[model samples]
Target: MHRLITVALAVALGLGAGSQAAVPFYDTYQLQCRANFGAAFNLPAGSFFTSSTPAINNAGQVAVNLVNVNVPGNPPGVWFGQGGTGQVKFVAADSNATIGSISLNHLGRAVFPQNFTSPNGVYFYDAPSDTSGLLTTQPIGASSFGTPIVNDLGQVGYRVSFLGSNAWVSFAGAPPVAFHAVEAALDAASPYSFLFTPSFNNSRQIAGKVRLGAAGQTGENRPDQIRIINPDGTFTIIAHDRDSDPNSLFLSFDNSVALTDNGWVAFNANLFPAGRGVFFSNGVETRTIAVNTAGIVSTIESFGPAASASGLVAFRAFENNTALRAIWIGDGTTLRRVVREHDIVPTDLGPARIDQHDASPVFGGSITINRYGDVAFNAALTPPDNNQIEWGSGIFVALARTPGDVDCDGDVDFDDIDAFVAALSGPAAYAAQYPDCRWLNADCDGDGDVDFDDIDPFVALIGS
Candidate 1:
């Protein structure tokens, strides 16, 4: 029998060794955690309530706002969750009762409030050095560094809501220069409504929602639109359909918007009660995703695989209807339903409801997909406490397999490599070694063959 061998297999092996698929986000960290109290972070059994903001950095570090309710009031400080090391560390401590909610960047620097009384400002905590850097301390400007989103370039996006004017301020470099805010020119309804909801990508394009009016008497947001601000303070509204909906379009500002390096923004918009569909790669022109129709009307918790270095975003779009729940993979333009038999429970926030104090039935707490098309999501075991019960739910994180997954398992491993090898290997080859191999590119060592160079690495990293 003529044994078929792959040439330049070693070079292909080297190329495949450190290479990752083009995903929107990577699954570097995953855990099923449960906080003790109604709090965010589970700190010991007694003592401090450390509930972290849901924001996570590319490094898998999470920002935790430590509220010591054991002291009688809301005394908040900032903390960091090093997901890689399983370390939940304190970043900054508020002594004068000045700090507010915490925000962190991939570099692990945290931004919190600083109390000085003259020019109240934000402080950055360098967790690596345990030193604090003050952005501002005077109250004359009395500006806020609220809702901060930082990138690896040391550029920080914060809401400077001051003096009846709400704008976005991007701070770049160490000892950031006295950068002014990006003031979006509104057509005059209410100046206070211009809350700059920013999603900063590596390209320095800060995209966010700007409200047109103040909170309505019905407790509803009057009207708002999406806009993008470049580094030089120039901007253009990407989805400001003023003539479209009467009640405006986007509902919630938090976690309702996302941006990618490819000038793409993952947003939720409505075709006037066709209900809210989580749209991805929505540029100047509105685009609908291919998720389940039921999920289109439901609240999608997270978006993923993450923007690969090549700018591909992968995420499981979760939808919960009164009767059915489904999870789908959402690329920029297409959403492919992955699983339809998922059972969804309401989150801490309840079942998905339009008006009133009810929680949206969510498919999961948090969702992320890696460049390898590996899907991950956090699901709630207990229904949200909108019913006001003290029963805390267990948040379990799960993962899904990708298309190149030749083994049909939730991960890429030796079986997958073997299957890939078998596909690349011909009939006259050693078929017994990799009968199921399907991925031809995985045959790294070539020499017209698939051997240990491919199998060892694939088997060694099943959990990675």
Candidate 2:
């Protein structure tokens, strides 16, 4: 089975030309299922669900706002749980509030926004303390602050109301740093650009949306933006609504942007003459990794990108006007679909293999990818019923595998040999292209580095 998949990758990736860009073969690992999600709740019979916006840290620790509802209860309260095994542990609870977002850092701690509650505001959860604390309790009022994100250094950043965002850093002995409003830095450039949907990285960088005009503008004039706030207080407007920069030709930068530890920001943008697509920038050069079915730029969702420090990017895309949807991954140079609608996937039902997937239409859907090449996402499973189709929503995780599977088609063929040679000659060049990735695949001998020792292993891989 592995050999066949490898061959498919080699042929599909156009490896005969020895392109360095590669597609990856992923080993899918089912971490939890609908039963697992329901198991987290101690509800009556069948009331179960977590917030659609789930988070996964680098250590594979997934944090979910498990919604535990009871029969005839006032409202559902969001519970927090972690890890793959065992029932979920207890966390904070709040009725009359629907959490817009929850983000987990490397330490498993999280900061999120809660709207529709008394003193509506954002809160923080610390695993070490096993307690939830307040970042700000003042009413969020509107869904202005997209989602609050946290870093390992106890630095949390989020938008406040509709004005802008602020970063709150915690110090042990001193009073928490006064909210360092990044918007204050942004207003210097674009006057009254209401910032929303701020994301954070360990490097103290934040990327988010900045509304160009006043509130209540909903049309071609509606607000849309993409901005990156550096730690040094300098800000860059990647794209915005009605932007007229002839060089890039972007009609509008969508509302969501994902940030990684090294400051790589990925966002979906609508481009003039190019359509919509996912773009990644390191505050330097920007590249549109994926385009539409006609090779035109496009994106599946508004906030549709999840990135990792290992240079792996996960996103969803589809044809311009079709139900054919696909989830894709980009390994710096090449972008390839991991799964698609109507694609057959093996199931444990013994004789039944489900091939169709149901698409989710919710904004800010929980899609994630880690540095280790593991992808966590939520999609609906479509199985044929009696002349009908039944949909079952599920959360999944896939691990990237197959070394030398450049162009990640899963095959290690002659194309890999040439690509590997180029990578070996100057790994720095390749690393520069994939700053978040450390493609150590050339270490065929199982040694740490891709050095001379890997030559024999490379030969064996080909001979096999």
User: What TM-score does model 1 achieve against the real structure?
Assistant: 0.59
**Total backbone collisions for each predicted model:** 44, 17
* lDDT (10s digit) by residue, model 2, range 1-464: 33553454355444334323334555354543332223222223343443365577666656554454443443433334443332333333555655656777878687766666554666676666777755665322233444667778877666565343333222222344333333333335433335555677776667776655433323455545566666454667666555434455567776677887777788877767756667787757776677553452244655458887656677877644445666778855677666555544433321112233223441125577755566665544444442134333444555565465433333566756555654565578656554433356665665557765666666556545
Residue runs of model 1 more than 4 Å from their true location after superposition: 1-29, 38-42, 46-52, 69-74, 83-88, 91-103, 112-120, 130-140, 174-193, 211-224, 242-256, 282-287, 290-329, 333-464
Where does model 2 exceed 4 Å of error? Answer: 1-23, 35-51, 71-83, 90-93, 128-130, 133-146, 162-190, 213-225, 239-244, 293-299, 319-323, 342-364, 382-391, 402-464
| lDDT of each candidate versus the true structure | 0.45, 0.55
Q: lDDT of model 1 at residue 300?
A: 44
| Candidate that scores best on TM-score | 2
